[model samples]
Every structure is written in C-alpha cells, then in structure tokens.
Target chain A: MLNRYYRVQAGPEGYLPPAAASMGVMLPEKGEALVEGIIVSEEEAMQKIAEKIVNAKNPVFFPGPNILWAWNDSVLEKAYAVNDLVQSSGARVIPMPDYRPKYPMINPEVEINPNHPNLTIWHNHIDVCVFVGVHCHYANIALKIIRGGTDCYTIAICGEAGHEDAMISLRDVSIDTLRRLNDVIKSTGEGLK
Target chain B: MNKGLVKISPCFEDVMPQEYKELVEKGSYGQDYGVADLGSFKELIEEHPLCAGCGLALSMRLILASLPNPESTIIVGSTGCSALAFSQVALHNIHSLFGNQNAVATGLKRALKLRFPDEIKDVVVIAGDGATADIGLDMVMQSWFRRENITTIMLDNEAYANTGGQESGMTAEKAVLNMAPKGKNFPKVNLADVAQVAGCAYVATCNPAKSRVLEKAVKRAILAAREIGPTYVQIYAPCPTNYKLKPDEVLATVKNREKEGTYPTGEFISAKAQELFESLEGGSK
Candidate 1:
C-alpha cells in the first residue's frame, strides 16, 4: 500500500494502479486518467518498459508463480522467451533454488537460491528489478523490505496493483501482456540505445 | 569415521560389482536367501542388510505389499534406516535430502500429473519419524495444507535410529532416551490427530507387527489420496539396538506401547472421503 510514486485505490478488478503514466503515452481513445486510478494499457506498459530496457545499466528479473499460472500450458516456452529477452539485455535472473531449483530457469540456469538475501547483497549495484507475475507470499516479504530499504527501482507485472514494492505496476495483465512486453523490448530496444 | 566402514568391509577391495553380477546370472538362488512366500504371488522387496527382528524393515515390507499399483507408484524416501533398504526394493524410488521428502514429492506429483493427465500415478513419501514429525514436519504439514494428492508414511521408531539414537520430536514424554538424559519433557507428536485436523482425507496409526492393520492402512492411504486429498499412515516401529532390547523383543515393545494407551492403532477417514469411497464402492459392486 505504501509506495513512493503510485497511489492505491479500489478497482473493478483487484486494484488497478497505472504503471508509468508519467512516461507520457498519449491515449485519446482510452480517455483520460480517472480520479480513482490511472488505467495504463498493455501497449503503453510495454513501450515504457522498452525504453527502460534499452537504457538499463544493471537490471534484474525475479519471475514467480504467476508465470506458471499465466502460461500453465506452455510455461517453458514463455519462460524461455522472457529469459532470452532479459539475458540479451544483460540482466541477472534469480530464483528460489532450495524449493524448485529447475523453476527459475524453466529451461536451465547456473545458480539458484531460496533466500532473497542474495539480492540484498547487491544492494548498491542493482538499478532496477523486474518482477513478472510474482506472488505476495512466495518471497517472505523480502520484496517489500528490499524496496523500503534500498533505492532500487522495481517494475512488477502481476494480477493486481498496490504491490507496495514495485515502482511501476502493470496490474491485471494476462499471459499475452507479458509476451508482448518481451516482444516490444526485443524489437524497439535497438532504437533507444 | 572410517572405523565403522572398515568393520562392515574387512577386505573392501575384493567386494566387487562383478561378484553381484555373477550371483544374479546364476538366477537359481532366488529361494536360497529365505525369501518369504507369505501367500503373496510376487515379492516387491528383496533381502537387505537390516538387523534381525527390525520392525522398520517389516513395516517397509508390509507397505510395499499393500500398494494398489506397484508399477505406477513412486516412493520418495528421506535419510534414515529405511533409506538403506530402498535400493533393494524393486520399484521406482528417490532419496532426496534428510527432511525434504514431502517437498520433493509435491513437485514430482504435480509435474507428473501435468505430464500424464490421464493416468493415475501414486506418489508416496516413506520416511522415519525424525524425517517426518521432527525436521520435515513443516514441509509435510504444508503439503497437506495445500491438498497435494499424495500419501505419506512415517515409520515412527521413537528416536532418531539412523543417527546414533538421538532424541527426536516424536519421543514420548517421561521416557529417557539417548539425548534426553532426564526425560523427553514433551509428549509424542500424535501425527494422526494432526493430519486429521490438517485436512488429510485419510489418516491412520498402525503397528507394523500387526501386518493386516498396517497393510490395510497403507492401501487405504493410497486409494484415499486419489479420490480425496492427502493421506498419512504412521506405523509404530520399534528399534532393538537403540532400545537395548533383544532382537526378538521389538514387536513386544510396540505391543506394550499400544497396551499402555500411548500408540493406539486405528484408521481415521474424513467425512467427504468416506462418502466418496462408499459411493465408488457401491457403484463398482
């Protein structure tokens, strides 16, 4: 509920707080931002993220159970797509090693750990952490603590907004939204740099 | 550290894999090792190096015999005496970490279900009391809470029999064991009661020495997991070496515990499971 930039409010869905509305995506057809909360479209969310992806110095991706929930049928394919885009952008990916070592890298990875302290160790180094479809309970409140203590920016793509941790929350997104985000980054990423 | 290893193998260099291969090639020595033909058509387990009158070993044999479909069942074992004989059993088995049997089984069951979808593959967790009720209790309880379609069998041998008879959480109150010089101070964990409250569709406590009760409990646990949610079967197994009793007195120890009202043997089926089972049974008939 407590965030640096975004304000929380109830929506028809869980909670829809606009992600990167300040990034200036002109949407005359979708209407202006509401008094309740700004409703950012998937295309706008992807475009904003694309700019960040090309300009990122040290970005990290922490994918969670939502990835499994969204891409229940083809989890491996979606994970590989996300991994390829993140890795190509020179981002570090970490997963809960102890519980499911093969989960983070639905394909394969070199390192894994359940404890989130490994993320805290690189406090000053990491500029942004992209949490795609992460649940609230999985990380032991480490996400909230990490955002509260450190200056690292976070972008959460999950079922709802008001995730306290993420600076820009693309709330109430489907599996296609995530895939398109990766695609946008893959295509327009070269132009930004 | 190497003293015990040396004693088990006096001339370890000569104990080669070729010797076991030749013994298998002979093929006529099936009945030579005193394999019991206890009215059963087939034997799922083979002779192992467990001590005489070992109640845990007997419990494992009874459990293996009670599986509804041995070919489709996968046993996930933890570190303990039972793990030593797991390799000897003629079935699919996995020995993960000491207290991670339930966690490993959860992932395996979910993954298997996703892959197969049509076939019913039974995934069972078979481990000692120390692995289940003590160290791995959180994982076991969490799996049950999540309603994982799996069966868990805890061979309750009172103490940590595998690790030099140390005191475990399942150790009975006022009983003086290895680590508890004065007394255990706490009562034994009634895991059957815990399982019943934790949403387990089937829960039972049985003495392995009573072969019929243990077998029935194991079968029900497996069958109930398919229809209902998770199931748990706790077998009261006694250790002779740790209890400082004669090899023939292990069953007597379990009997005394049951008689003293410490470890009662009976099955506890949930209401939903009972209804579903009876309907399925009636329809089949």
Candidate 2:
C-alpha cells in the first residue's frame, strides 16, 4: 500500500503501520469522531501521528494563521507548544508566505500556500506533512490537493472536527492537546535515539 | 484558455510545480463539479489570507467551485479583501485599480471576444461592496447599461472591512462603524434591484450561509451573462471582524438577518435569460 501511494523513498526503517488500515473498525456512528474516515481514539491518532513524524526522513510542519495569530496569551502558548512539537520531531516549519507576523516568533525555512501544499511538499521532498492552526475549509482544500497530487502523508491538527482527507487528524485540539502530542513525539524520538 | 495550454512539457514535468501538474490532470476545468465534490478534486483558489470564519472567503470558495468553465474564465478583481485571496487563485485574474474592476473587465471581455470569437471566454468581475456600490457605482452601472458580456459579483461584507471597518454604501441603516460613528443614516443600497432596473439579464441576491443556493445563483448568473447579457450576483458575506462577532458566528448572523427581513436572498431572470435557461435545461434533459 505504501509503495502504491508514495513515489519518494521512505525512511530506512520503512513505512510505519498504516494508521487507518491497522485500525479494524467501521465508520463511527457519529461522523465527527472519524479520523481518516474511520473511528479512532484521540490517543491512538496522536500516537500514529507521532510515529509517522518520528520515522519520516523529511518531515515538514505547515502552520497556518490560526496557529501563529495570537489574540491572547493562551493562543500564544499554543503556538509555543506547536514550535516545541516541531523541534522535538526535528521537522522544518513553513508558514503561509503571505502572513504578516503577529506574535510568537516562527523561523520558517520556506513559505507555503495553505491551499497548495503539494507544491511545497514536492519542492522540499517532504515525506510527512503536518498542518496545524489552519482554517477548516482551507485545510480541507490543501489536504485534498496534497492527497491527489503528492505522495506525502498528510496530518491535520484541527480545532474543530477532524479532516477525512488527512492520514491522521486530531480533532478539537487545545493547548493541552498540543503539549501532549509534543510530549509523545519527544518520548518517541528519545526512544529512537 | 485552451486546455492544452496548461499541459506540462514532458522534459519539464519533473521540475514544474506539483500544483500545475495536478491542476492539469485533476482540476475541475471542464469537469462537472460543484460544492458536493469539494474534497475529492483540486480546487482553483489556493490558500486564502482572510480571517477565520470569513463569510467572503467561504463565498469565494463556493463561487470559484461553481464556475461552469474554469479553464476559460478570466476573473477581474478590485481592491478589497477579495483581492487578497485573488492573488492565490490558479485562474488568470486581473486586479485592476480599486472601483475600476468593471471598466477593466469591459475592455478585457471585448478584447477576448475579438480574439476568441469561436471559444467561450468568461470574464467575471468580483469586487467588494465599497467598490461596486460606491466608488465604482457609475462604472458598474455603465457596464450593465451597455449590456456588456460579463458577470459582476459583489462580496458584500456591508462595511469597508479591509480599511479597519469603515462604513460603505452597502452598510445597513443605523449600523455603527468607523465612518458611521453614530449610525448609517441611509438603508443599504439594493444593488440587486439596481441591476434589474439597469437591464441585467439575470440578478440574484445570495449569502454564503446557503452554499447550494449560492452555487446555483452563481452558475445561472455566469451562464446567463455568457449568452444573454450582463448579470449580477450580490453576495451578503458578513464581515465577522467588523461586525464584532466571533468567527463562527458569521453564518448565524446571516441567517438572523434573513429571518429579520433585513438581508433577503432572491433572484430575477429577464425574459431572455429565462428562455435561455429553459432551452439549456431542455437540452440537458
């Protein structure tokens, strides 16, 4: 399945367990609970996301305005947690090119359009792509385009319901959710080390 | 506007942006796509820089998706929040001076008609209410009066949102804003009615809250303008930032306004446009 989807060579360790395929379950009774069109617990989704990031040869984090725009201190803390997650996972961060800086400094190696994720992924040779703090509609558009056009495994950390197009999407993410994901990635990275 | 024009050369396919490659292969250029097929295909507009829960962004997304022929469509935009998003759209868009979108579109459409007399080239003018109903009202009306072959769409946020939330001609009566400190003294300019009176073949008033309805209206307006005459679609995309409402509260505000008999949504088709739609429907059946 990985050979069928991915064009670029994956990490030396090979592709991690197929997150959606490994989960033996039908669609959730409530559609909102679906991650990658299947019902998966939030913890399980986070674990799968961490595994992909930890195992990816070239992982990139594309943070949208929602993550970087700090209207208050809580949002700023969430932004910092995102940065920590990127650092722990050793993933490069790319912000929307048109974004005017607001708060919580982000050092983006490159700029990407949230609507055209495939261009960035193809240019950067990213094997695993994560999107956080993006508006739901824009994220939906980007994830679909990435799935249709590229081989990168896409993850959407959404503030609302999870995205069906992403490989593993964490829904209703709060600051705590960000910290927990970061911790999980950190532990997984430490174990690998 | 030829579909073949977007084809990537085999030699440059590896280096061309993946987006261009996908657009040629999977985009809804000549395909039958609507809001229902959103997540399954490559959308035209790329990432937008509008505020979260912006009604204008949502409306633009729906409108772009509803275009009957995107490959041959040339969008004419003016200075506003819509212009910010226009830069990222994959289509050939012209961002002329503020309030001069109609004038530019008129020239572009005429020139395209002369060049591609055989092909269908859609020239769409999309601008904010300030540009449509105030600063460029005369030009917009002139285009309608001349029966130019173009579709004019208004992203009516009701206020000059990009300029820090000032009052526009489309602002509702008694609405407080930066310019209208106390309140707007006049009622919102009914651009739909004006378009009807000014000899538009098709006129529709819609909001982003009703996606399917807005989609049908956009399709009808664009299709009507192609054969009938100039058409207009007024979209009541409420500005969440200027309205001092939460981002998620935009749809609810639109629904509430509709219920209160304030911003109603309706459509008017001239006799010719109605006949054209009937003939097209008959052929499809």
Tens-place lDDT per residue, model 1, B1-285, is 111111111111122233223323332122221123344344555576667788898888878777776657889999999888886665668898989999999999999999988877899999999999988999999999999999999998888886777878888887776666787887888888999999899998999768877776787788889867899999988878677778888888889889998888887888887786677557331
Give candidate 2 regions above 4 Å deviation.
A1-193, B283-285
Candidate 2: deviation at residue B240, Å?
0.7
In the range B1-285, model 2's lDDT, one tens digit per residue, is 656555543322333345556877899888899988998899987577899889999999999999999989999999999988887787879898989999999999999999989999999999999999999998999999999999999999999998888899899999998666899988888889999999999999999889988988999999999998999999999988888889989999999999898999998989898888889877331
- Candidate 1 per-residue lDDT, tens place, A1-193, comes to 2234454222111222233233332222221111212445556656766666567787777655434222334555555565656656667764322222221222223222223433432543666666654554444254444444455556665544334334455655555666667678877766755
TM-score of chain B of 1: 0.84
lDDT of 2: 0.79
Q: Which stretches of candidate 1 lie over 4 Å from their true place?
A: A1-193, B1-40, B280-285
Clashes of each: 1, 1
lDDT of 1 at A168: 52
Candidate 2's DockQ? 0.01
Which residue pairs clash within candidate 1?
A97-A113
